[model samples]
Target: MKADFLKYQAQTTPHPLAMEVSYAKGSYIYDINCKKYLDFVAGVSACSLGHQHPKVVNAIKNQLDKYLHVMVYGEYAQKPAVELSKLLASHLPAPLDTTYLTNSGTEAIDGAIKLAKRVTGRSEIIAANKAYHGNTIGALSIMGFEERKQAFRPLMPDVRFIEFNHELDINQITTKTAGVVLETIQGGAGFIEPQDNYLKKVKERCDNVGALLILDEIQPGIGRTGKLFGFENYNCVPHVVVTGKGLGGGMPIGAFTASYEHMITLSDEPKLGHITTFGGHPVIAAAALATLKEITESNLIQETLEKEQLIRKHLKHPLITEIRGKGLMLAAMTPSADITNQIVLQGQEAGLILFWLLYEPKAVRITPPLTISNEEILEGCDILMSVLNKIQPTN
Candidate 1:
């Protein structure tokens, strides 16, 4: 299986962890050798309730028994999708009631950008520096890092970059701007949280300019950050909220939400403005519905902060310079990129799972499942500390 994976499967990077997975449950994954590796990076923050969560699994099974893909998105009222959207509306702020589901975070982000342009009739978009929305062309166009995108030029035009959490840059959002897109917590850029009401100020600026603010909650949504959404931590509501990652438990799903008035703009003038055949996939929607219900109904969301504190307390080591982020979404920065790489590889070998952020080379990602227990946290941290001690610093 490992040989076939390397030969047949497409590679993201030459150095894939290449761990042969037999099965996974809760905060642990078992390899073919039956080695249990404690998962700390929950599938890059996708597995909210960990692997094969009962609620999510049962929801999919229940939906499968009924039907699947009866029609395209929004044409017919599917129960799972309908209920999921309505549930989202109830949880979200006013004017963010309507939702447009997609296959992934990138597609949802593309829809949000299109909606912003269609509603406001503006082409100019402002995104944050080092901010990552998605990998799609429309999303890549708005991405802050130019080096990675330089090869893929002629992206969506009129996309400008601004510094994240910089209130002074709010003045750049003029009436000409259709939307200002930003991750509620910049994920690829080392999980940087908004500082001192920065998001609120940006919201005010967008309000003044009649520009829409699109908050990318892809990584921080779905109760990853103690709240149902990361934007809730900051006292600002965005014009459009893009969500995915853990929204579907372990299933793939994404959604962009707006109010009835704002969402309606995507219809009419250009009929079928935004359409996706598999956007609101019934099975995925069922999983998402169950995931949302689980997060909201259980004490999981509230307990995230306590779990975060536990990880932080146990993960402390002289090698770990600092910890950044809130709730379960955290990054442990080591002395150097070399040291970070060593720790990640060593931890994996030592029956622990660790991963890296998209952009921050020196930071080790620690976004575990929201369902991870206190014992699991301690266990993973022990492996990490052991790895840290094994690798001495050159400095």
Candidate 2:
């Protein structure tokens, strides 16, 4: 099977951590050998309610019995899509009422960029340094790093770059700019949060320049950061918000939301300006709706902070320099890429699932499920501590 996987699969990286899975429940995943591994990365922050959550699974099963993709996104009055959009609007601040659903976060990002251009009638989109929105051409155009995107040459034009949390860099945004795309907490840049009202200042600058602020909450949203949206914690409401990842509860989905007045413009002048066949697929929508309801209704949201504290308490080591980010969206920084790599590889052997961030080589990704128990948190931490100790035998 491993040989077949390597030969058949077109992998993104040269070496992929191909874990042959049997099934997963709650916070643990089992391999074909029946070895259970405690999940810490939460499927790269996608499985919010953990793997095969009862509600999400039931939602999918129920929707399957009813219907699949009946029509295109906006034409059909689908229950799951409509309910999900309405619920999202209810949670978000005013003017961000309407939503356009897509298959993935990257598509949603491109949608947001189009919406920004439509609303403002401008061409320039500004993004921060070391930012990772998505891999689509439009999203990639605004990506901060050059190494990953250079191969996909001639991306969307007129995209600019700014330093994350650098107040002086805010000057780059001007009246000519259509939108300023930012990760609420810069994920690939080692989970760096906006410091000293950095996001607020950016919003203010955008407001003054008549440019839209598009917050990519794909990673930090969905109750992972103790808020439905990470921007809520920082007291800045964006003109547009893009979300995915944990929203699907192990399913695949993405959405870009803005005001009805702004979103309506896409339908007339160009008439069917942006359309997707499977964007709001009812089965996936059902899963997303269920996931959102469970997140908002449960005590899981508040418990993120407590769980974060527990992780911070137990996972300390001399080799570990700093833990960046809030709630469960954390990055434990080691001294070098070699140490970080060793920890991730050894962690799997020790019955714990760990991973790494994209651009940041020295940081180990540790985004666990919101439903992960306190005991599980401690258990994972102990496994991690043991791994770190072995790596630091001299100390």
User: What C-alpha RMSD separates each model from the true structure?
Assistant: 0.9, 1.2
Mind giving the per-residue lDDT tens digits that candidate 1 earns over 225-321? 9899999999999999999999989889999999899899888888899999999999999999999999999999999999999988888898898
CA RMSD (A), model 1:
0.9
Residues 363-390, candidate 2: write the lDDT tens digits.
Answer: 9999999999999999999999999988
- Provide the lDDT at 282 for model 2: 95
Which number leads on lDDT? 2
- TM-score of every model versus the real structure: 0.99, 0.99
Q: Clash pairs of candidate 1?
A: 95-259
Overall local distance difference test of candidate 2? 0.94
